[model samples]
Target chain A: MSENRVPEEIQENAAHEAAKLGIGTDEWVAQHEERTARKKGLKGVPQFIDESIPAWARWVVLLAAAFAFGAFVDNQYLLRIGVNLGLFVMLSYGLNIVMGYAGLLDLGYVAFYGIGAYGYALMSSEQLGHHWSTWLSVLIIIIGTALLGYIVSLPARRLFGDYLAIVTLFFGQVFVQLVLASDNITFPWADDYVDITAGANGIPGIDPFSFFGHKFLNIRDYYWLLLVLVALLTITISRINRTRIGRAWRTIREDALAAESMGVMVNRLKTMAFVTGAAIAGLAGAIFAAMQSAVFVSGFDMPLMTMIYAAVILGGSGSLAGAVMGAIVMSVLPEVLRVTNYSEILFLAVLVLTLAAVGKSVKRFTINIVSIALIGFAVKILLGFASIKITPTEEWVVGPVSRALSHWMYVPLDRVLWGNCAFVILIVLIAYFTTTTPRIKTILLPIIGYLGIFLWEVRLVTDVNTTRQLLIGAMLVVLMITRPQGFLGKPRVEVL
Target chain B: MSEKKPLLEISNIDTYYGVIHILQQVNLRVDEGELVCLLGGNACGKSTTLKTILGMVKPKVGKIMFAGEDVTHQNTPARVKLGMAVVPENRRLFGPMTVLENLKIGAYVRGEAAQEDLERVYDLFPKLKERSSQLAGTLSGGEQQMVAVGRALMSHPRLILMDEPSMGLAPKLVEQSFEMIANLHSQGVSMLIVEQNANMALSVADRGYVLQTGRIVLEGEAKELAGHEELRRAYLGR
Candidate 1:
């Protein structure tokens, strides 16, 4: 209907350069959508995002919305989720400094978080014989973590590439081993063996942070505290990124040899990055320990680390705002999955969003939804003709949506074994769906969608932990494909 | 000419990539305020020489001197701090950073005068001044090359080494970049430019060294070497 504002010459020039750069012509969805929108004489949503709101203002607005969300929500579960989101935001930012800015993959990053939590537990708990003040404990923990980060980084100066990864990963494993087995210690000429770490039981009754004698007692209190800290951290980190140190880190990230030949102290700057990440992670760990009033070795393991990494990667590393966005989505998602009704809504909502976003046109998206619903009902009718009645347990289906879904879909009476089979079948169908032609793809999608719903209603929604992990894994895969630079990160190009 | 010490001198340098020799008995030099070119085709160790001088590649046996001091053992940053700045192959500007930030990184060793040096770079490349806030990756190839040169200038080095400045630009832009190089040379900045663009480089350089399979096969005034028929066929691709 309209001639594109972007001229043919500009398009040719971009394609020419992209070819020279060896790019395969695939671009991020947001960028591709904007061009399509311009071609169709319609203004894209992101055009406003790109041209009008500066990145900093967007961050402020988003942060303000988060603050508002925290201040108003009265549900303790939601507030607890809010607090956990805050911790993840902090964790992502810290890891962003090391992995994103400096391009160092420190697999043992969570060890520093564990260290900080345990440090606070020891300092502020009655088990340590004398409870220290919260301010002093926090100060000491931060300082100690920074030093620990520096010490750990010293041995890595000689290692580079994958060798560095091996050393750091081993360090992470060592931290877990120490925490697990450090139950008792016998000193030479000592009368008895002492329990330094309280032996696997974990140190509990950690004192909450108190400022001006006002202790942070409620979930909302920790949420507010983290919000302010995150704001401060975001500002401070943004400023740091513009300094001489930040530039050096970026140069090293781009090309370490080139950076070194350009006069950057690459090793030292890398270490500084490690120290910064560790300090931030430790601070988050301190808050997390206080929130639960306990520090457990089991809670600070590899899976928790994966969650933090997911947030960092999801948001795009090297961006403060990206980290926050990723953390909020990831932290809130698992909590939603914990409740059957909420999870069902979330699942359907995500499915709808994916279908709408991925389909070529509105008509196709609508048709797909209708076809999926019809396919499910047809399958149910066929099963009914076989004289078998399938109904899910009533206890798990309380919501109006489930009640509506119950009437049309065949919910297995004994779901666990059948649900497992459906999940495996769903996976195989999804794998095949990717390989089929568009015509076959259209035919197969409704079956896949119906199967996905069947598996979720029967098995997945009930197994919250496994489902959350699956969501996180799925998020990582989708993020890597759709936006590798992360939502707020600058797209990077490597020459070799 | 032989009595006066060269600003930089590399003698009998032998380098290896694992077991394979990359640079064999390589020798080259850049006099103060003189524009020199190391001309070669692919697999001729042109890049290895630059890397050796920058101390990114340690020579198995060699002596590298800058202003009469041995620098063969020095690491890259040490060489850079000792007044050697490089426009690495393909510009290598921090792609994610602003042009201003790229210049700042170039002057990483000179912390106190970073601002003043940045101003000087902006003066040399005035177009860079107008677009200093833009990301380096977003700039055109010609502008990126200018930024690379400007970044080198910001380091305030006694010598600047550039690798393949004309590799990706249009022919007209290549001519313009060469003109800029000659202009910078006229302003008393010594340089050793490494290039596969022999015709363009020889036009600007005072002296030329044609490298083949890690050895210097020809060395003379740029004008005289450009006129050599066989050398022209192999390297200039005539």
Candidate 2:
């Protein structure tokens, strides 16, 4: 039937039928709108985009901009970096829902990301013997991820915060190990399950995406696709935040007992945030799968988790803008560092020192002067030495020029001196910054108040050689010392 | 008002938090439109009994019959739906929510009665309407108490449970709250109140129960309880 031929009574009937079935009118309208939009071949129909331009035209304009910029850069390599940044933005926004808004710590968020990538890979790759459309796989990826999120949260959510984070992290590790150890569960084309994941070797022959019979092989097209997804994700999260359910989530975050007292279904809202966050991660993962069209164990490793957590923290934890900005920084900074040819250890040292020098109590100009001087000093020392030799890995080399410069660089004494200087500068910066900034001082003040309070925590994690132990330990100490609630968390007082 | 059944009946209710038994064998009853106070000193089982009745704490034993329904094991939200509301001790307002939002949430289970009951609440507390958009936490103690009382009134409950309405208030505000309570009692809203201020509670209540530890020590007409030598000496500082 034509759209016009559908009678008003019939439409009204469709809307009201759910009410007749004992559902609330408001809930009925929401569900009916969702169903009707799906049947009518419209996506986000009720959603308002700018009236001046159709959404499709806006997307075209964005795609054109990305392509033009990519071409101007004169490097497919830089274009690839842009694409990776776009994907991280998507993941970070998704993570923001759990960590930022809902205030749940999900350590193994990458499990859903992995599920999406693998789901798309299995369906669309040549290894599967037949290719499913990327769009179809994307849909499947969302469903798979949402289901996984819901299931994982069912048991995991019984525990709160640190306990939940550990469980999720364990879940991710177990999932990865299962794929590595088992062969029968994987497709027949793979010699082993480990081979599909490539345990270490990684999977190849992953096909580029073709959605709605249109192929988008280049980074430029992927950037456009991801930008649109990111926009939609933002809209979804913003709407949820404003909705009654979102208000419920915030109430639960503030005080679970109080929220329960106020007649909110606290457990339900917590579950929703976890599942929704996971689902969004899955969506990003599907796009990621299509972007790379390849798989490997290292692709979804511990570093991915670190980057996500860093993004959440660096951005204002509960703020939407914070999460988005955090993701963008986390994604782009590594590439920027790669281009600049800076050492990760050196970068970390500088960051820590910079953070210290800019402490809350310090004058603003002092922070600026100290930060600029430190940067200048590091650059001068590196340029002056010009003859040190050290090699970690190709990724860690910082840049091609840095690798070349390292050949003639100093070996023992100079290297030690540089390291020591950086350390000393970092300590000075920390001391200066802490004394200056009350926020930084507040963080350290707790530890000062109870000297060596975290010594037991440090000793407990000494067994785990992984960098994760340090990250977890530092996060715990920082959280406990600075603001027990969180860095930017709101202080909530109990009524009785 | 009804000879057939009391508006609320509490029979031998015991409440515990872990191993600490807070309320033991607590019994109270309110006939339709009757104003009653569960009176006690600090650390007494009055608040615990009120919480038990509101389903904030489930009774370890005994049934809570509200409007002839067994609400012994029902949750707070469920109890709220059955025309039961509480003005909890210490003015348990949603700090971030605007005063209006706090009132709106109180009527969450009110369903269709929201608009009418909201109007009634506004009429009852004009100060709330004036500062409806203000965050409840920012309000002064008396104003917060007004929000708390207005929120309970929005439910248009058959039985309103109040726990220490006069606590932490200045003398003038405490008198004002008690005066408001008297007005609400006269408006035919049956209520079960718990209070440290025995004289004020007894002055308004038609009947009163004196609880010590977890058990009711005295039960009588409000006038009789008000003049009792033991009660006056112990609680009223007479």
Candidate 3:
């Protein structure tokens, strides 16, 4: 204990030195403590959440909640959404291995999913007059897609970055074309054209997954199966991420030349990553085909690919839990948007949250909200004085919040045009706001906020599909500006 | 010195990038348990020489013998597996990875028996042990250099190829880096260091080769090269 303690003479000498510097020891110590406290405060809530709970425990709790929700939920629509979330989770996980871990931009990932579905359809349906067992069909499809992935990677081995993306994207387009043209294939040896993929009409009456005669006919049954698959895949992928192969993938992602110099077989590991991702996507596709009891060419198009990429990127591409969370959000957000009242509530809540987060002070937040209200009322009064006919509150407004705001906001008869113009002006204002001084920015905030509400309530809300996409784009843009690493991705330090 | 076995010998290597000649008829060697430094000014093909030996760039006309085997056409990973390690230019540390992970990657060819080597590396740089969990990018320049050297040592290589180890270090740290190199040389580890800093490199090397415009203009014992009038005027600045 004596050895561990500072000597009394040394302590007195430190005090003497402090006195010589015109400061007391206590004052200096207090300042040091304050700096540390401020540093801790900067870590904030997210850091608290990260540190207070172990990852595995959090995962367990999340999975348990999902299981309880799925098991007891009565609505079929909700069950369907759960099933779709599980499917997206599977696809996002697959894409994560390629783009997140290996840093390969495989734009043709959905083609593998399509292949799985089509393969399952051909093997287990009346389309080709073959009815193989579901298990056998799924197994063969998974292997076939993995083999296809390997073949695709052979040409991709020498290619990198944008070139790889271009080639894979070409493969995706080729797959769609082949599927479309296969319906009228005329072999050189054959005299007549043979219909194969049924063209755009697609394959119908696909067999449901059956385990010893217990057919998974109900959406609930498929939901449970998908939930299990997602759980198993999450565990498997996470385990793989901790292994030597995963480390090699990450090294290659960081710098391939350095990885190769370090004795990692970069090409082989890249192919392995591609194949693994393809196989996972293939598995999801097989289950999707079985669940729908049909396969369509349109189902595996660019839009689905975009959604999967969005899920992976939004969740934080390299993170397992991030992929799942991103999938859930991407899948369910549109469904929530379909209901006007829910989306309205969601928008308002998000708006308030953003203000609270960005405002930093209570006074600023209050001022912003009050200014937005005042601006809305002033605009309404100005329009009234000009003799512009405002639509009655009960005519078009559906949600409670929108109805209440009808008094303050001006809803024109030609809302679509007004909303369009407002949207453009809002965009310009936001752009200008970014380039302005802080004082101008504060002045512009309420105006922009009021215009955003106008655009949403009057125009954007009616066009659900476009609005959903616009929201996603806006989210991605904001995320890139604020957190380029995504929600859970660790910020990378690129070599100079 | 003549009886010493050559661990790596490169003869008459000609390297080109799209018909622009980078290295022409370059010959170099590092002997067993020897510290050899390749000295040159900027863009004198010193890095190219190292890359050619490492099988990163294919030489149009050359033979490379490493540890008594002809390895002229082998790939980078194959060369790496044949007991070669590199502390590349700019350190090239996996910036997002931990210090320990970067070291572990150096043993990729050897597989999971690097625990002992890891301990040895920790012994060599005790500062690294305390910062093992810290990301390599966040480390100070001296600490990052320590990790780079530690990473190379994890491979348990027959020879290490270092490209500009002193390039980004503080002046004081440069002396420390050379001391670390001298310490490793004393422990019987072979090394081939490519450097523009001739005075520092020659101070610790046994043999030295001075390259000029993709040609080896001078080759002799380190003391002889250091004392040579022409070498001193161009490189030593004396």
Candidate 4:
């Protein structure tokens, strides 16, 4: 027992060694572990939710809900919106493969969609005196568009970043110009000029999609068709992502040179991405043309391209679920904006949501909202004293939300002019608010809130299109500042 | 050392970036199970030699033979499949991807049957197994270096080309890196390491080649190169 017991000096040296190694006492170690565990518990909640639910289960629930909504909903307008959303979802998925997975900036992606539509239109319609079968036309369009996409991406193979974007953009413009000008063609050996695309008039009388003697007649039919296609696409793309090809594509996106050195064929994979994306877009285009019973070059213009890009970005690039969610939001938003009642409700809801988000504390949020209301009433009274004629509520305000807002907001007789002025001033105030001190920001918050409502009621709501664009722009700016990775994307750490 | 079989042979190769010649008459070789270091100062075309061997940059003249086959005109992926792998400068791990994903990407040519290689990598660097799910970019420099080397190993390459394995690592970690390289060398894995730290590199390497500008200015056994008066005066800071 005496031999087993350590000497005093040896024990002291052991303690010194433990201290030198930064190994704390048992209690201290336990306390440190507890603190770290608490922190991890807080962070792990969201991640736990993510991991607990399998991706397949979530997708099943989502698709089932979508299917139920489309199947039962009798309203044609709503069904049309659903169908259009499905179309946009398909486009986003296609773009996600190219720009998200492979990181190629194919600005001319919509051109593939246009080509598919036109190809289907020509093959199925009497435009070129051709009435190809529905399945055959769609198959041909998909294959032809994929080939075109491969050819288009050939020149862009050596390009990167902005240069790649420029080349693809040029291709997009070329597609548009070719479609526009090809309406009239007089060959040296021809007797009469040929009408191909029919110019600005577009190609009309395109056949509706029919399979196994079942014609897709109603908006609901198209909606169901799109939903099926989207579901299939989702499964296929996600499967591809989990496979070697998808990993190769992502590696190329991350670092092409590294991917190449790692034995991933960068150029061939890039071409494959382009072709797959183009083929998907082509399929969507053919369906879209059939649904609309026409194909217009204008329909596949910059605005549509912008919407698809915005949807992909908003949803979170490189995420399949994000693309679908973004497509739903972008597609439904404009339609919601078209209706005055829905638009008013949306505007106020967003305003309140923004306030709640910015003012994390309930007290701060309350103070901001109260101040905004007080300022609005005070401004109305001041305008009354200044003899500025306020418009009567019954004359202009239609919606219940607008009617409620009319009491506080001082809508002038010439609201359009007043709104225009407020918009410019609001822009300046927002710019100033971002750069100023916190105290100044508190003061500016109420003012900005009041002005935003003022602009919405007085000017913006009247111009639905502009308002939608402005709102989307503002949303993107805020999202970029707060969460650049978007709703579903993982936060990436770039080495440089 | 007897009857040496060169796994990678770059003979009188000249490479250019547009009109600017980057590597001139760069003749180098790595035999099976040998550790060779390519030593040079900054911008002395050390990296270009690695790139040319990997077929990222096509040499204007001469040939590159990998595993005794002509790979001069072959693209990077082809060369990689021919048993070449590079631990690139700055440890270019896919920042957003996990350590395991990066390793899997290294096995891109070999396909999904790299589970055995993956386990081997983890066995070599057990700490990497713990951090396999963590992003490669978020790892410490030493850890990242391990992942980079592990990633190269996942390819099961006959010749691993390391571009500055010691760069951006602490002094202690630099010693550890060389030790790891020495360990790998002993395991019969061939390597062609490009380095600016002549001392550490030459210590682990069996033989070394010194490049000046774009040409191989000096080539000898590691012991001789370390003791050379001119080498000591220039790179060794004697």
Clashes of each: 1, 16, 0, 0
Q: Estimate every model's Cα lDDT from 0 to 1.
A: 0.82, 0.67, 0.86, 0.87
Q: Model 3, which residues run further than 4 Å from truth? A: A1-44
| Span of 10 residues, lowest total lDDT, candidate 4 chain B | B134-143
Model 4 global lDDT (CA atoms, 0 to 1): 0.87
The residue-by-residue lDDT of candidate 2 on A67-117, one tens digit each, is: 576557657787777778777877777777777666677888887888788
| Candidate 3 chain A least-lDDT 10 residues | A24-33
- Residue B199, model 1, lDDT: 84
Using DockQ as the measure, the top candidate is 1
Q: What would the per-residue lDDT of candidate 4 be over residues B94-156, giving only the tens digit for each residue?
A: 988888888888888888836789889999999889888877766667778898999888888
| 3 or 4, greater by TM-score | 3
What are the per-residue Cα lDDT tens digits for candidate 3 across B1-238?
Answer: 6688999999999999888898888889899999999999999999999989888889999899999999998998888889899999988989888888888888888886357898999999988998898777667667788888898888899999999988877565788899999999999999999998898999999999988889888899999998999998897776
Q: Would you estimate the TM-scores of all the predictions?
A: 0.88, 0.71, 0.93, 0.93
Q: What share of the true interface contacts does each candidate keep?
A: 0.55, 0.15, 0.50, 0.64
Residue A308 in model 4: lDDT: 94
Residues A1-496 of candidate 3 have per-residue lDDT tens digits of 1222678898798668667644312333334335323224323444455557899997999899889978799899998898889899999999999999999989999999999999998888888898898889989999999999998898778988899999999999899999989999899999999888999999999999998889998989989998888889888888888777888888988889888888899999999999999999999999999998999999999999999998888878799988987898899998988787888888888788777766778999999999999988888888879887666778768889888877787888788889999999999999999899999989998898889898988898788778878877777887767667666676666543
Kindly report which residue stretches of model 4 are placed more than 4 angstroms away from their true locations once superposed.
A1-52
Off by over 4 Å in 1: A1-51, A62-76, A158-162, A189-191, A210-221, A392-396, A494-496, B1-5, B18-21, B112-126, B129-131, B227-238
Q: Against the true two-chain complex, what DockQ does each candidate achieve?
A: 0.48, 0.09, 0.33, 0.41
